[model samples]
Target: MEAEACKKCGYTEFKKGKLGNGYVNLMPINSFFSSGSPMIVTFCGHCGEVSSVSVEKPRKF
Candidate 1:
């Protein structure tokens, strides 16, 4: 896939970050006991704009 430019700054450089904590996670709807997935965050390096947020394991959700 082509790398997307930042909507706010049109920057081509981006970074990936993950969101996770021992007590918090992104779980599927109505799945109370399932082990959840960490969120993947994409952002523009130049302007610090968040481009997208997604789950690391989409099939799990």
Candidate 2:
């Protein structure tokens, strides 16, 4: 995902982190190692401005 420009300050930057994909202990299921999707949260580190960002899914070959 690409970082977005802040509307309030016109700053372009992003902070990264995983969003979801929790492990559940169920029968015949070992989803404990699944990796959650990542999100690129964009915000102005200086001015504290923020904006929502949408990105395309990663392609696999």
Which structure among the candidates has the greatest lDDT? 1
Task: At residue 9, give the lDDT of candidate 1.
Answer: 88
Off by over 4 Å in 1: 1-3
Write candidate 1's Cα lDDT for 1-61 as tens digits.
9878999989999999989764577888998777888898999999989999998878876
What lDDT does model 2 reach?
0.46
Q: Rate the local accuracy (lDDT) of all candidates.
A: 0.87, 0.46
After superposition, the stretches of candidate 2 with alpha carbons farther than 4 Å from their true spots are: 1-5, 10-36, 55-61
Clashing pairs in 1: none
lDDT of 1 at 23: 55
Superposition error at 35 for model 1 (Å): 1.4
Candidate 1 lands at a TM-score of 0.79
Give the Å shift of residue 43 in candidate 1.
0.2
